[model samples]
Target: MSTATATPEGALPHRDLSHTPWRVLVLGATSGIAEATARIWAREGANIFLVARNADRINAVAADLRVRGAAYVETAVADLDDIDGHTALLGRAITALGGLDVAYLAVGILGEQPRAEQDTTHALHILHTNLTAPVSLLTWLSNYCVNQGFGTLAVLSSVAGERGRKSNYVYGASKAGLTAFLGGLRNRVDREGVHVLTIKPGPVRTSMTTGMKGSEKFADPDKVAREIARAIDKKQDVLYTPFQWRPIMAVIRAIPERIFKKLNL
Candidate 1:
């Protein structure tokens, strides 16, 4: 599969997108939340570049976006965990889209916690995919946006990161590290005119949570996507989707570690 797509000749390098379609790059284009958010952007006639490891699925997403009224749609197949290829992939995305207005990162894994507890390799794999890979992508993206003095970096983190629960502490650790990285990235780039939005979602319904207990009770991914789109438009620094996770996580964070460790989460 081709790692990148072609851009039209004479595509504008960069411009104020307020009057034109927003150019967007979605890292985990096949993820439920990212795809849903892209659909909203498509309805606004955005130019979009989708990057994901799955060719068939990403192509379907691109076709859907095109039919939904995206001004331009392109897809590149890539395994985001392969950090060495990120620079090249990101370069291709920018070249294809002409410029990037928003980059949404939704790549992550909810690994088996039981296996992670007993196996160092499994735990490290989760950390690498969820934490290390995103950090690498954001590092490059932040520098690019800083140089341009414009762009939005919206990342999908989880409220589970607020406090470590015995059930999924490994996954939570990955998100916690990501949340910290975004916070620091925002502190560095906001003054340079770059917006870094840290999205903390509380168990939304998606492929990752398909078989989990109480999946029906999970927040709708579409609703979460709408909130995310609004947050980016407003240049909000942090968002807790469903509007309840903010206070929920706040209470969770405020619980004393002494008492928190004793209760089942």
Candidate 2:
């Protein structure tokens, strides 16, 4: 039987896949959250399509998943900043998996605010990587999944998107655009048997925040992965990774703009 035709035991929402294996395509496979999520899904018996820019890192992650009992694992290298490559990358991932059941767009960059302020190029790069690329990829994936008549498109947004703050407004703005985009995508695909989940994580301890100082209420990558898996299984529309961020962001959103501007968050 073809690799895609071989069904992995214990795949979620179990279905007869005589032509394809139950597969997940993770865009930022080397990222902490994506890596954690990949491990969790591997444990659950799902084939993984690990996509990242770094070949070595992606291969290492794929190997790690194999060691962790992943039924099947594949890696693809693509720089998300290459706008022309988005659709092709998604298509390649789908083909690699023989099909796709879940597509996680977890690729993002958290650039330094001070650097962004000084360099327009850097700012635009961050915006494109964080917002534009995901939007374009999801648009393609959404149409593809809808045409296939099933699948889930999961996006990792941020609590920072809830409201713009002085510290990371550019980053937050990009996430804000993503959050809004996913909201519309969710509404559009709900009746089509396609699931769209927008994950808003307040603070996560990942390489993205490496060297950042001080203790804060941060969610571990593993914890965030667990929440993501649960949200996918439950077909949840929106999720706050740690759950507490929902109320916290609500309050942050409610803060008077004048007052909010006065104090650094």
Candidate 3:
């Protein structure tokens, strides 16, 4: 894609990709939330470049999106944990899409707390996948968007990140790290004509959470995707799926440490 030669003179021009036929890069493209969002984008006729560890699944998703009205659909198979390949993969995505209008990073893994506590390697692996690798990708994309002068960087975070819970503190910590990273990155990149949206959603019905029991409060991935699309259009800083999650997390965060520690989350 052709880009302007010089930086804009003042505040960035307003641009929204939600309903337009724009270019989008969906990292972790085969994941439930990512795939759901892809469908929404497809219905709006966006051109999509998808990257995920599962080649077969991504190929199927790409095909399905074509039928859903996507102007173009392309797929690449790779694990986000392989940080060494991030620069090249992102480069390929930008080239394939002409310009990346939005990049949704939905790559993460949940770890068993008992196993993580007992094995150093297990905890590190979760940290690597959930936090380290994503930071690398976001850093690279940040610079690109800054130079190109427009892009939306939306990363999937979790409400668990708001506070450490005994049930899933290990996974929660990784998410907390992600949440902090996005917060700082957003502040750094906002003025660069980039909108960094930190998407914090409560549990959603997905294969990843299939083993999670008693998910009465869980939501549908499609519904969460719709809210995400809305956030992108509005260039929201932090988005809580279901909207109710915003106040819920706020209450969770406001609890004093002394009182918070005394009660089970």
Candidate 4:
């Protein structure tokens, strides 16, 4: 058990468990980035609550974490798109863990841009999954952490959100909304002693982008995970996972709309 402190939200008091080990809840536990992060945190002796919709994959990952020296490993199943399921899933994980010290919101879908534009259903699903779901989950989680008085909430935004490109603007748009939401969320919670880290990763070679080409600049999931862990320790406000992407995206974001539209990015 850790020492508890009162927070502004008055939900659940937080504790300084840093001297002990950490307990982390990872949404999208099956994601390459999330899985890698879990491994890194577990290696440092954190208890892990891995949440994902796939039971087989989650269990396998949990087992791996235990073998790798995690203090404890637990699993929860939920599809991010299912509102009720996501709520129940998170509630159960938090209860099982006793408390949450860190949360990584790492679920997203990258639908085909053309398909999303052509189909309302596709666009809606993408928007809901990427933007709305995360916003809702973070709102709940942040409140919980704020009341607890100390915790870090890391949200995975993207460079695409900085400026939409013709190549994948629909997906980019969804991320854009998420980025904005997280910005406001950070502002609202920081005063309460809760840290929010907005991570904008440019490219990653994950199963999600398996067929994508020209990804030489992509960061590895393991590297990204390590960076995230370091950022959390430092209480960073926002981070470009690779560090290099900050300036790269800055230039991209500064491009004039007319000229940017003419160029094939």
RMSD of each: 3.7, 5.6, 4.5, 4.5
Task: Please give the TM-score that candidate 3 achieves against the real structure.
Answer: 0.91
Tens-digit lDDT string for candidate 4 (1-265): 1112222323555557545578799999999889988898888888899888899999999999999999989887777777655556667778777777898989998889888878999989889999988877887788777777778999888888988777888899999999899889889999988899999887987888776786655678889888988998889999897899999888888899989989887
Can you list the residue pairs that collide in candidate 3? none
lDDT per residue (tens digit) for residues 1-265 in model 2: 1111212223334223453445899998899999998998888678899889999999999999999888899888888777777656677777777777889989999998889989999889889999988877888888777766678898999998888877898899999999999999988987877899999987798888876874244678898999998998788999997988888888888899889889877
Candidate 2 worst ten-residue window by lDDT: 1-10
Best by lDDT: 1
Q: Per-candidate TM vs. native?
A: 0.94, 0.91, 0.91, 0.92
Q: Which stretches of candidate 3 lie over 4 Å from their true place?
A: 1-20
Query: Of the pair 1 and 3, which is ahead by TM-score?
Result: 1
Q: All models: lDDT?
A: 0.90, 0.83, 0.86, 0.83
The CA root-mean-square deviation of candidate 3, after full C-alpha superposition on the true structure, stands at 4.5
- Runs in model 1 lying further than 4 Å from the true structure: 1-15
| Candidate 3 backbone overlaps, count | 0
lDDT of 4: 0.83
What is candidate 3's lDDT per residue for 96-183, written digit by digit as tens? 8877779999998887888998999999998999998988888888877887788899999999898997778888999999999999
Worst window of 10 by summed lDDT in candidate 4 = 1-10
Q: How many backbone overlaps does candidate 4 show? A: 3
Clash number for model 2? 0
